[model samples]
Target: MSARTVLLPALAVLLLFALAGSLLIGPAGLSTPEALLGLFGSERGPAARVMREIRLPRSLLGAMIGASLGLAGAALQGYLRNPLAEPGLIGVSGAAALGAVLTLYTGLSAAFSLALPLGGIAGAMAAVVLVQLLAGREAGTITLILAGVAVTAFAAALTSLALNLAPSPFAALEIVFWLLGSLSDRSMEHVWLAAPFMVLGWLLLASTGRALDALTLGEEAASSLGFRLPAIRLRLVLGTAFCVGAATAVAGAIGFVGLVVPHLLRPLVGHRPGALLPASALGGAVLLLLADLVVRAIPTAQELKLGVVTALIGAPFFFALVLRTRRETA
Candidate 1:
């Protein structure tokens, strides 16, 4: 077989290795075979409880959230026809973050554990609706981006005002943590709470692959090929809000998973919009899980936030992308 045929299997093996490492090694370390057996309940021990109670859900959430963000990124990039487009960059994530922050600041999250994620969905929905009202309708990619820019600025202002007026106790640090993002201490409840919505979001985005591909040539061309722009846009907006919102609600505001994942895998998929969606989802699952693993293993007095790790990796790559895109357009 040619070298071209070898790429996928290699990536698959790498993903498997990442998954294994995530499960086996952490602050509370578990041996390889022991971890596997622990998963099924045969091996009852401290390791088992830790695996079952703590690491397992966090790992699963890492994968699920990463996949959601990656898939959301793929959808936005395809629909907007811009490689720089990502959920967070375009106001969806910011809006969700604002919603989550509101609950956190109000002390409602303390009383109602489920309030954060539900409120996040509401925030994301509001943002999507606003974007639709402001920038929807076959706008060129530049116009959509500018509209997103405007919305992002407005939302940021609103979030800042909320924070300023928040009660004295637990205000600053909570806001910082929520904005920075993390996956630590997450429980099985979070796993169950967020998974269904994330899965539904993925399904909606995944099904749009063909439509995205059709849309690459332009809405007129896609419509000629039987694609409906309004319906596709609606699905994309609602789907992204559900997935990304649940994720942000559960994990705070982990940045760049959506942006980083899709960009990282684009070359592997021959830059095809359809293939980018799933490949990005898988690649994202790997990246976020591995990052979580790294965060847990570090011996720092205070545990590293999962977002800090991913941002360190994502920021440089984002700059490179900007340079490359500018070069291409120039």
Candidate 2:
């Protein structure tokens, strides 16, 4: 049997288990049976309220956001033919975070519930445009990476400037915490706000799988295979913007899931970029859900931000990956 066939079902099952853990485990200390009862039972009780209101939304958002990051990462990597390509690495997530910060700075978020996400989406779109303009249509891998790095660095600088000039200490703190990323205190309203954009993004990214496979044989070959390069690029940019922007707006700047999940699962899927997308999505969900559980379970005085936890784990992996790449090239 192909590894893809075995890995997909395993990932799906693991995702279910992660979801269950997310739903059942919390600070409230509800027993497994009680949690299940609260989740499914029609009873209007405290357990049910906690299960339905708090944990459910948090779990769902984590899964969705994780999937978004993972799928976007895979798609970007495939399109660029670079394993290191990721939304966060490519400035998409940073730009989205800057947009969310602008909404906060302008107080538009307070005035309009949707303003924050819209702002993020706008920033993400701008980043895509900038990257495309800088890299050019026929840019090589080095050129693309340089463009992304330039964009990411600029976005981070602007974000830092905003924090430095924040109206008040309280506002600065809030922005800092948000940028660190967490799924805490999120409600169903956030889920509702982000879901449509994320779903649309998923559809757009998923549609590129066949094109990505063909492109593995090179751009000329893909064109000969009847895939329109310009259209594919458009879909990828739009899909990534939608996914990363909505996710960052709702859940702050969670990172690394995209960078890590695709690389980890790529070999499992026989290094086929087409096969990697779904697997990465499932793996991302499982990783994030479990990370959420860990943050909650940890006895820290304050809960660690989801982004911090991911960075902590992924930074080492990233270092190792860089070293491995260097060795292979050397």
Candidate 3:
């Protein structure tokens, strides 16, 4: 009956159709209509394997990674009260990439699949700790952004240096892909590999929903309302690092899902932090699944990376925000 009421449901329906298209449209298109029937067990075809093994897991992983990125981004933005805040900008992705790079390039992942995620989690944890030490309890927005910039720059530099110093061709290629982010040929092993950690990370982040809402006014106001600032800070940091780390372990460095999804869905959820989290997650899953489908459909002969597509879409959007801010300040 009204603008606010009509728009959200319309957007939701569109997102659902996009998701269905993602499951159906690909380089090897699934029977889709039949597969939808098969989902209800009314039909059978060659699509069963394609849908079950490849599309299903890829869709699931895309959803997982997208949700993780979206939640992390929303958490950072709410925690810092800055619209520009994203996990990648704050060194989470770089730290996670660095960790995975070390394990995979050093030949450790060959011996142990868990090594990749473990290394990423460790690197992310270390970076966050350093950020806490430098920024401290009295940090303002300027301090928070500055600390994140410094850590991200340092982690990126170190990652480049390691790639340059790599001992072999395999190491170099692995580093390149780690930075680019892909979902190609990813199997059930990867599904299981990152799922538990991703789920755990989501829980940790979701726990901070109330804290983020409390932070809207000011630290003093939030503290007066019985929110523990220190505990809030800890959960935000650990949850972001763990989830981002685990995601990079499997998906490499997919960008912009965190940056794009929350900003897009914030209005739909009435700007409520808890509602923002779930709305962003569903939106993110849909976004990444579609992007992965594009990567598959494009006739590159060689597959395109997921990050490349998302960054191309997101980079201009970010610059537009920057310009909008400058105009507003003026």
Best by lDDT: 2
The 10-residue segment of model 1 with minimum total lDDT is 2-11
Specify the poorest-scoring 10-residue window by lDDT in model 3.
37-46
Clashes of each: 0, 0, 0
Residue 169 in candidate 1, Cα distance off native in Å: 5.5
How many Å off is the CA of 82 in candidate 2? 1.2
lDDT of each: 0.81, 0.88, 0.77
Cα lDDT for residue 41, candidate 3? 56
Query: What digit string (tens of lDDT, one per residue) describes model 2 on residues 166-257?
Result: 99998888788878999998888889988998999999999999999998998889989999887887688778878887898888888788
The model with the greatest TM-score is 2
Q: Give a tens-digit lDDT track for model 3, residues 203-264.
A: 98899899889888887898899998777876777778777777776778888788888888
What's the TM-score of every candidate structure?
0.91, 0.93, 0.86
Candidate structures ordered by TM-score, highest first: 2, 1, 3
Give me the displacement of residue 145 in model 3, in angstroms.
4.1
Q: Tell me the deviation in Å of residue 126 in model 3.
A: 3.5
